[model samples]
Target: MEKKPFFQGLTKKTIALALAVILWAFTNFELDVERDVRIPLHLSGLPEDLIIVNNAPENVDLSLRGARNLLSSFAFSNKSIPVDLQKTERGVLKIDLKRAASQIVPRGIDIVAARPSKLSLNIDMLVTKRFKVKPVLGEPDSGYEISKKLKIVPQFVKVKGPASQLGKLESIETAKIKLEGEKAEFTAPVQLQLPSQYMEVLEGDHVNVTVYIKEIILSKEFRDVDIVPRNFGELEYTTTPELKATLVFNGPYKTINDLTSNDVKVFIDGAEMGESRVKRLRVKVQYPNSDLLKLTKTSPTSVRVRVKPPPPEESPET
Candidate 1:
């Protein structure tokens, strides 16, 4: 094997050239540089009753000046600017972005400028209010109806929001409830529909709603209902012009629609009437299913009745 020298192919001029290039690169790397860093904007120290509104900036763009090496490392670090609102009042608030960012930057880095030098915020006081919960209901089945007033478990709800918006809110409604083809009573848990995007429900966001449903009540009129006499045995009793009645009944839709004159009776009682030249008696009505049907009205409320003694039949029979 041939012996090789440690300084083989080396020269004094080559050494000087390498040293010059190294120094130039080190100087350039250490030179001051400018860059734009995008960092999050943090809001802190706000009073519990106060809130910032109206499109506040969420992140800030900082124009930072530092050494080339330092700027590169800082871009990856966790950097943010926090704005203190402890003493803020309800109104428009303005803050300087450069001044806010300078507090968090590294000691050697300078925040020369910011994209948005000034920030504007709309501040408002927070308020909580209780409002009635309105239920949004849909139509029921074709032959059904709402039987009575609706029942809500919790009639009122509390909402928190900016005072400017909450002042205009009068009530809150539940998410729409579909009752189409619903025939029976039911209970449901429904969420609330907020009127404003900034409002939040406190304690609970939903309520229990109870709905009542029943068959619809319908009215039907029956014409020419015969009026009969009762308890007039062995006596001739005639109504002065043969009275007939018009009867109106109210019941469930199915029962009322299927009703006929045979289902109802109109009569006059002779036992209740006293002996007089011309007896005036009030008409009465009888229904088999009293629990389901009701008589609402009857025409010819009263009728004149004449009673005659039975013809002399005792002599002929003897």
Candidate 2:
């Protein structure tokens, strides 16, 4: 049998198909398409002791012109523009985005424009400082008081932040531990309160706080405490119905048990009388242990005071 020519088996349809494929490739490769790509801006080569203090753009819109096929391949892929700050000083520094983009982009792709042509970076030295942790507490229930100081585990924490901002910080506070209506010993874990966004707790962020609450002893009721005159050396002053008051106070059990009527002084100020014949005055309580004792109630908050002039002076003239 005679060998058929090499082109004898080639079909017209196959030739047309090959030509179409070649034409498609030529068009896609030679023609250019415009596309907008969002690329991330990566900061690198920064020392461990330095941080960016200002808000900088993390991503930039890059307008690129390239072949359609090439552009489509980078649709979902992110291109990074690296910013080197290894040799930079601590201050505001400007980076040229155009120059950075040119170095990273492939040869076929042209960077038409960047939305933000320049990036402004504010750098600061990071500093680690110690701060005392203060526990925040709320008011306890009535007749109850915090008997002991709030105890916190790891009373202090190390914080890192911009040196300028951290210099003024002396102490850090914990999240509020509510003691409202709390009457017993309580313990809880609380988070540290950071002063600013630039500040961070380098050590443990949480602390354990213990609170001690104690109930006050039963209040003592003293009947008929004598009311003394105040600032009445020359003027004789008298209160109607023999001024007396019932006093109720609360304190430690031993303190309240030892308290006597003589330990409390109830009086009305003479200066408050003015010239009125019948003047209403507020009753004030004075005690040696006023700081430790809490006055709960007074029978009559105010009293009617009457001022009188001595009438026996006329006998000296005779």
Per-model tally of clashing residue pairs: 0, 0
Across residues 73-113, which tens digit of lDDT does each residue of candidate 2 receive? 76436568888889887998999998887777777888899
Alpha-carbon RMSD of each model: 6.2, 13.2
Clashing pairs in 2: none
TM of each candidate vs. truth: 0.64, 0.60
Model 1 alpha-carbon drift over 4 Å, by segment: 1-27, 30-36, 63-66, 107-118, 221-318
Best by lDDT: 1
TM-score of 1: 0.64
Q: Residues 1-318, candidate 1, lDDT per residue (tens digit)?
A: 765775565687689889999987786576567888788888888899987767778788888887777776665347778899888999999999899888888777888888788999889999999999999998887768888888897999999999999888889999998888777899999999997777899979998999998989999898889999888766677786867899999998777877889978899988765666468889999976688888999998988888886567666665
Candidate 2 to truth, TM: 0.60
